[model samples]
Target: MGRPAIEVQGLWTQFGNQVVHKDLTLAVQRGEILGIVGGSGSGKTTLLRELIGLQPPSRGRVCILGEDIQRLSAAEQRRLSQRWGVLFQQGALFSALSVFDNIAFPLRELRTLDEASIRDLVMLKLRMVGLRPADALKMPAELSGGMVKRVGLARALALDAELLFLDEPTSGLDPVAANAFDELIGHVRDGLGLTVVMITHDLDSLATVCDRVAVLADQRFIAVAPLAEVVQLAHPFIRDFFHGERGDRVLRAAAQPASSPGGA
Candidate 1:
């Protein structure tokens, strides 16, 4: 908590008369994985969009690395963008570009690296995400949903960003695939010492990866401690979400005392 890597103070966003976010404030520490969760239409994505400069907050301040992004000059903002990376929710890959080009896109646009160096860098990023060098030459359409997401992740790392934002990285994948993707995220963050801010509905991720979780509720974010504590919350939506219809049986078993040799 030594001066948050990302800070938001009194943030607000609106769509005409509709208020998406209000009086929102949050601080994310460097190298920490922070998870955001909320019901649909809760402005979770809106908050991320505002934080990353995709959309301006209707009011308030967003500071990253001690600089207010909204106040920065165009060139200054572009320069700051180089230090952060984003993976959109749906694996927003360029349909026409090959995976190699997609992964190299950020580096080529932001840096003055030569073609040879860019290729080397792209290949390294692809391999880091478990994709083979040969796979880099293939187009996005040729890859499966899971592979496409991994390629998007590789692209996010191309800029050598200190902060990474992933929007539903595990969505639409099978359970096993999603679990593998989660492990990859943890591994990548550890290997790169990256600070991750993710928006996810997956409780498993909260338990397995996130350092802290913030729930969007009543137009503000409230930090929930451990995954179990989050599960025990009294909010109707929170309880229904974490303890789905079938989850009650599991919870009861989990709460029950251990069996003894001569149970009464």
Candidate 2:
């Protein structure tokens, strides 16, 4: 509804002779959840790294929250980082740290908070992600797959970021857990008033959570629109991605007649 939270103009990223993205331009509006999807090796993660300032683009500008990220000084970049958070493909929690410490990591880096305040903030973050207080004492290795994801999410939200990035958030969970996680994301987004940009291959997730989807191909987004509108497109990749065999299954499921109470 407001201005763009992220703006990329003429973004070009290259790894030696392989160009991952070329002239890629897009703007992610504030308070929206946008999913980016493409075939394997379509540069989803690469694009995320570029946006987060981990991977610098060979050409073009990346602006975050109205400021040109690439032009910012070291100190300014660090300050801007506090406004956003990212959950990588596999949670990526530090194995050496307990869940509590992982959630507290970013807060500790601020070096301004006393231990008591840090504990209180960390507990709040854990609750926001649906984790229990007892979980704080467990190391990453002790958590189950779903619990690990929640802890990573807690750590990501620990800084109270308005913008969130998720890379395959539901990748390893069972269908039940995946659906629950999707609902959790929706709840958290609306509850926190956060802007989320996610890179995911889960179609059900797109149908359930994303407000819009950006389909990447030929080194650029061929379409960025609501799932309903984008799924109707005839583009080869877009059509197959949304209406192919797997997509057909999703569609078929959606078309199934709902059973009446106690009736087959």
Candidate 3:
């Protein structure tokens, strides 16, 4: 097989006396969705920052699409960054910009497309994320929780990025909306042939769209495998997370046939 889309080796993160990651490593294959889950304060966000070059690891190597991010020059890094997109937990839309302008932000930054072309591409992205053209005129403040996520997703795909990073993609939505968002993620990934790495605590999302799930604990990834296989591990966190009341409910729901829209 070819090199993985993302690869981390001997990673370590430290903040003064506190060490966040210790010899952590992982690999994400091309065109697959990998879910990252960890308990509170497990440094999931920190790891993500390092992976995307927002923050540097104390000692490690991070490679994305075969380039070592830490070794890249500024111009090279900027060019490489355009190959991937990120969706922050709260959608992180520009408060002052309308939906149209928000989705157009990245494209405009490229300074390559004219206004007419930008408009056409923005509309296409909006449609790809299941939003209406008229909705593009609305401000971020006017959007619902689900709408915010959809808009964030649309912007994430605006660059036609080969890799997508999602921080808590399905948080703050009702079960139905979250499920719908998960379906949209799967649809978008397959349609765009994108490799996705998402940090999510939503079990329903893991069960629904993730090709593999990675658990972070004890300052490293404890297990990275399919949900069923990971759940079978002897780790305490795995047991509590997958066999607990909430986990059991989600697992049961996932095992059965697709339920009606009214179901959680």
Tell me the RMSD of model 3 versus the true structure.
4.2
Tell me each candidate's TM-score.
0.91, 0.93, 0.95
Model 2 bad stretches (over 4 Å): 249-264
Q: Which stretches of candidate 3 lie over 4 Å from their true place?
A: 252-264
Each model's RMSD to truth, in Å?
6.6, 5.6, 4.2
Q: In model 1, what is the error at residue 162, expressed in angstroms? A: 0.4
Using TM-score as the measure, name the better of candidate 1 and candidate 2: 2
- Best model number under lDDT: 3
lDDT string, candidate 1, 3-83, tens digits: 678999999988899988889988888877888999999998888888788889999999997889999998898898889
Q: Of the pair 1 and 3, which is ahead by TM-score?
A: 3
Model 2 agreement with the true structure over 1-264: per-residue lDDT tens digits: 556888999999888999888899899887788889999988999999989988789999999999898899989999999999999989999999999999999999999999999999999988988888999999988999899989988888988998899999999999888988988888888888888999999987887777778999888889987776777778899877788778876554434442111100
Ranking of predictions according to lDDT: 3, 2, 1
Task: Give the Å shift of residue 146 in candidate 2.
Answer: 0.7
